[model samples]
Target: MQLIKPFRKLVVSVLLIGSSIFSVSSAIAQESSVESRILVNVDVIYPVNYLKEEFKKISSNPTQADVVQIGGQLNFSTIPDIQAIRFSRSFIYDPFANDYYNNRNVGGSDFNYSDQASTSNPFLSATFTERKGNPPLTLSFNSSGSNPPALAYNGTSCKDNDGCVLMHYGYSEEITSRNALTPSLFKTILKLRDNNGNLVSMINAMATPIVTSSSGGVTQYLIAYHEQSDPANNGVLMGVWTEIPVASGISSNSMLLQKQLKDIVQNQSQSPRLSYSNSSNSKITISNTRYFLSSTQIPLDQLSRTSLPPTDSRFMPLPNADGTISPGETTKPVIIAQTQSAKKAMTWVINNKVDVNGETYVQARYDSKTNPYSGDTSVDQTLSLLCIRKSPELTSNPIPEIAKGTTYTNSWSGGEVFAIPEVVGNSLLSEQNADNKCQEEGQKRYSLSGFRMAEFHDGIQPSGFGFYAKSTDPNLSISNVRYWVKINDQNANPWSK
Candidate 1:
């Protein structure tokens, strides 16, 4: 049995009834007040003293294992009309070296490593005993010391070091209005483990008669110590863990790692969903569609790089000051500069590409001030343009196949050509009338109004022609519509009279 002892004594005294008659009376009167104060002070002071002595014992050596453990007792009593008395015995352990290392004594003598292992345990313990005839009270204990070492490590035994293990004992008591004792008990165990699930060190502690009551008052005791194991030459280390033996009302096995992981995965899978549509083109657009796919649908990393191409060159890149248009630069002028007609000026910057699951859409507006309308201010007005990157067959079917001098008519919905008219003026009346008449004719015809017939080519070109209608008298409504046209001719005037 390795035993370490710690003994402490405290004496409190109150004088009463001296030899002189007058002096004895004065002593008795002072006794009660003085004794009461001493009792209160002692209850607080005893625990503090116990902790302080423990610290001093631990700090005196290089390691906790250096101290010896001897079971000792704490004695408490109240002196007659004077003060309270209290004392405790300390338990200590011996220390042992884990390995031999080079060292020198105080005289600077060099000592080589030795194989002789020293067996010493430095752990200490203290005991408490209550003397009869004192008030019942509660006491608490805490540990204080230099910083302890880390309990766990990822590396091998020799690579990482061990941490300190501190043990503490404390008591609590509940007293009724009648001042009777109600005792409670508690115990705690703490262990430190590494990431690999290996226990590195541990601490076991307990407290008894935690709660008690008495006529005088409530009294309690505290004991605590620190212990460190011999460093392992095998390169293993320790970590921190906690255990409560007497958790009177706590539920067992309430927290687990599997449940926590399941919650995390579920939350990530049910993230917010989004949908999109290209209303201007009557096409469905989807943004972030890749996020909706299962892992088997496609490689997760490649989804972010996917994109759709532009519908047409109507939203083509603009040359910068350096004659180079970098990606992501907007070609359209700002709203402040375009003023009341900002919508028309904004067409050039619209992204014609539709993402089936994206949150954006494409729109086109003609800038009348520029091109084709040159020198024709009265004929200038912004027009909504529709351009689609359809298959070649769709483009060929819409081309007009009539002789230049032949009169033909056609009727078609704006949806057929993906075109919607936004604005029209009286100057384009003849062109608008011809476009409407063609629609009624059940035939779509090409109109060559503002351009020379000689400029017509087999490839695509802006026909400078479209359809329009005025609202009825009651509604005062107007329908301005437009579409692309392919024309083949034999030298007849394409402009309508």
Candidate 2:
């Protein structure tokens, strides 16, 4: 198993699509709600020789793509272990509905236009050819016009003299998976398209390890892509672009096959409804959706980019120093300082997306709305606390310690952003609450993945399911517990590659 260095850094350059430059402020953020941003910093690494052979096919013509699709699928055959699986997906900005500014363009909105930078463009491969070395590139969200944002390949843009796409191309896991079993790294089947709609579908794909086990085993992986979009067209649903290939050499009666079929049926039956809305527009709820073929071609201009509903306005209550709830006490999770970690969590939380150890660690919060745990709205309040200290680290790329004899694995795919709840404190909450929370919230996001408590807890104790440590500072009780979703200053990039 060969692994290339996963992440590479790149500088950003804004794209100038037209001569008429509209001097608009970058983008205003909403403090009272959960805001999401695009994560351009995370990168994918592939062998130079591998990319070169693929590049030779479509280097001559850059703008003749017939159809372009932006998502990939997981190959279950690569993983040998026999166990359960969970798949889910999320989006920061939808390119098929409308643009972020509510302005519909001739071809597509800025979000859709920016997405082309990664796919349906040959600039990234051309940059590699020019530099002769794989220097990194950065894709930023510049919501200025109907053009894609400019990406610098190692701080340099491609000259017009060189024939290439206007922007670079990169891929990521629009749909990701997690499993408790220590299965082998998954093989992804990716489809690469260049300017003019040429296709170079990729098989046996590998990606960066976002989370690893205590033994240095990768727990989760981020499948990279050149471009991505929610499956839709002209305000109509086209369905998700995904596939699951049966691994070769596995027997028909193998547990892996049985498990795969079971998971699909179980998830399909419990799929939830997702509602999208703007200020005065009625909510557009999408339910009972289907998956699109991996080889299908989707047009860029007709692709939709709609605004996501603002994060839940309500806040969760904070526990006292003794880890007990207070009555009528609803202090939202606070962000005392604009630390990198705080920005990561708040920025990506709105989309229910994360880099695991790279961007932010986002876990689904339990459902306190539908079936209240406390059975009393007052006590069943959700709490959002931002831990300032790193000790007993709240987030790690390595999997957290699990309970003795209990096995767990997790996978992330794409779904709508639902509340990510952490079940801590005493038995006032049952273990079942945590399980139901994942189902309830996952469903609301239009997903039905299994829930594992150890994903968030540092360690479980007979006393409760949270992390507590001794601190020297006495002034750090309720004040140390910070809130983020309600703060007005916090905002994240709405689109990422």
Candidate 3:
């Protein structure tokens, strides 16, 4: 089989942890002329220890078909101008290659190339594990060496503690629109999220706006950084190209993207319905969670991309241990950037009682503490993730005011507690709590009414407000306001939002 060969020599700098910065020594000339386009080179840096372990199996037992593959998907939807994409080349780079060729028995082959069929999915592929064929891109590693070896990219010393390998792959895509002398957008932005799904801001997380090379109607841009600390497992890298000469660095505060979520119902049904007293101050802007969702709707509304936040690890491209954005590097700013296990406080107010198809359902109001009454009710309280169970002891009664410093209370009949401004019912008030079930079912007969993440301020009211059957049960007729705590701690309950 004929091999689609990669360039004989391509210069790649090592800007990973404990590695020195290297310059590109040369560039391969384009074989043919092409239309103006953008070249996005995505390099996933794997730790030396991680790779050593990953390849141990294949190296120990060599086989003809055994190969190691590592790849990730790229997202570019944030860039509005670019509308189409085309696949480019994929290759592996070994910083130790030159040393191996120079009669120094330090490691294995420094450079290797292979061909993979391009697919519509934007996954960049790299496969190298055990050698099999002539001109093979795979090889076995020899860990027998005295002193740690020096990398070809500027003689940077490498050790297992902080060394890294680069699997560089890229795509060439056409921009939907642009100007005459300059490209539509120059700088690219990357947002990082931690494993906990919270946005993390670091000075080095954003790619440096550097135009590494421009040749043959194709412009290449490079983004180099260490693997994020506590990175989201499914994080993605995105960017756009521009003709602008200089790129700038972004502020740490700007790293965490901001979003606003409005509380509005997309679907509402009466008889078993949701009613909001007013819409005043019914929106919330947050920067903590990876994304937010619109609260109090028939079907919850998604308000933002579910992108994971970038790692807090210093962006390693700059090469300094201190890892700060250099004044010179700022010239080309690439655009930048189930279970309820515990008890959580919940307040349920009686909105109304409805009989639906011979089954009795209860509608309760849930809202944030600071929101004003939107419609006709005067309910005031904050909502939380909760499970509700029918109380065999109490009838429907309102506990209007709980003191500010009070922890939680289940007692009722003190006074007439008004209904909450935001009321939710319909499908949320189910005959069976199939969507959410109580984790403490063994002890208490509590069942789940609804479940929601903390990012959503409003959701279906607590489960205890209504009964599923209207048979001879006396509690169904005079069901009153009751509060049941739902577990909301993520650490304790994986289902906690």
Candidate 4:
């Protein structure tokens, strides 16, 4: 079996007791860019003693992967314009190369902790029995330091004051050798009645190192996240993550390369980059955009991308410790940004340029009320990816015009408690408790939802300038409204008002 869970399947969770201040050594969102979502690997750790010893070992001659020399990695997005949260000290690590996961001599020699060694994190016990009896479940992730590692946050899609909700940790589906070592705590992560593995938030249990043959006073493993998440599942093993992979020497100062990295991600080329903050008092001003859906009987009512867009488009990117973006192998699709007054709480993605029925339409899905961890799903508005469309606005502007017709609408009684936005014609989606059961109920359905992450647009196939919504009400009923309109469903035409 692989030393770590496949990045795309599932993860671990536990409440962390740590602190952090921003510094960059690391990694952002845009079209083709996957938002960095944090995942936990509780099984990895790095003893401080190991670092000190390694530092000493390399004092005479440094190996290529020397950590004291090279720094940790960052979690950057694909788009140049969008920025990822930077952690100067956050670098990626490897299990095979560094052997941080299972602490021991580089040659695989098992060792013991110092006679006066401190116990590892409590959750360490939940996954292992290496020491027999140590405090289990103690989540002191870089606790109370001005520079504790940051778990990941997209900086958008949050309420006035609430940063995006973090759900990085998850439990293993079945106990493996790591957790099996301590079967007693393993059950806690299983399907217990009240507390299951699915609930623990190991947002910061980034590293958890065990005793290895290498003599060291402290060992703190580096943890990195791939672009994978299973909200409906449980926690990642106790561990650590780094933005840059340590297949070779990793600097402790690579955090100094923020601007150069940001410059490489030219996402701001098309639309203006929107800024969002965590302060509830901090209000965002969305530029002019329109989205309307009016009956031919009411031609005056229209929907335009110019009028409104998805409310919020900010969330942490997929935790790609390797720093891959733009359709990363493990990265999830990007989240669409909004340019309107009301913020969208649910998430939206372009499923198809047009529907399976082969009409000139776009489709997507969103299920915010239930499990948001089911890849490509969002719970809050902080998404920073581009939406999918058929053509760039330059060539395909002015999509085929549909004569105004009677408005068709329907309602679902069991609507989402947290009104999510599913782009028009989208279907492959999951609700909180409604796994694989996404549905719509209307005669001539046109429930266009999801975000528009692209910085620019060309009225064309897949690319649309039309109606989508984020119901202001909790029930997701249409009564609370945000309707949009555009010039005949394409880029703004001379005819559009």
Displacement of residue 22 (Cα, Å) in model 3 is 39
lDDT, candidate 1, at 427? 14
Q: Model 2, which residues run further than 4 Å from truth?
A: 1-59, 64-67, 77-82, 89-150, 154-197, 202-204, 207-497
Whose lDDT is higher: candidate 2's or candidate 3's? Answer: 3
Tens digits of per-residue lDDT for model 2, 9-108:
1112122243221111112111111111112211122222333346466663332221122222222222212111111112222222222122222122
Global lDDT of model 4: 0.20
Measured against the true structure, the TM-scores of the candidates, in listed sequence, are: 0.14, 0.24, 0.24, 0.20
Residue 125 CA displacement from its true place in model 3, Å:
7.0
lDDT of 4 by residue, 1-497 (tens): 00221122111222212322122212211112112212222222222222223335434221112111111111212122222221111321211122121122222111111111011221222121112232121121232422221232232221212111111112221111100001111111211011112221112111111110111111111122222112221222121211110111222322222232232112322111111111111111211111211111110101110111112121123221222111122112111122222212223333223222242333223223311222222211222222321223312232233211112111111111122243321111112111111211110122322222221112222332222221222223322222111122332211211
lDDT of each: 0.19, 0.22, 0.23, 0.20
Q: How would you encode candidate 3's per-residue C-alpha lDDT over 184-293 as one tens digit per residue?
A: 11122222222223332211122212121122222212222222211231122222111221112322321111110011101111101011011011111111111111
lDDT per residue (tens digit) for residues 320-381 in model 1: 10111111121111011101111111121111222223222222222332222222222124
Model 2: ten consecutive residues of lowest lDDT: 334-343
Q: Tell me how candidate 3 scores on lDDT.
A: 0.23
lDDT of 4 at 108: 17
Count of clashing residue pairs in every prediction: 66, 59, 31, 163
Runs of candidate 3 exceeding 4 Å displacement: 1-36, 40-45, 55-72, 88-132, 138-142, 145-497
Candidate 1 yields a Cα-based lDDT of: 0.19
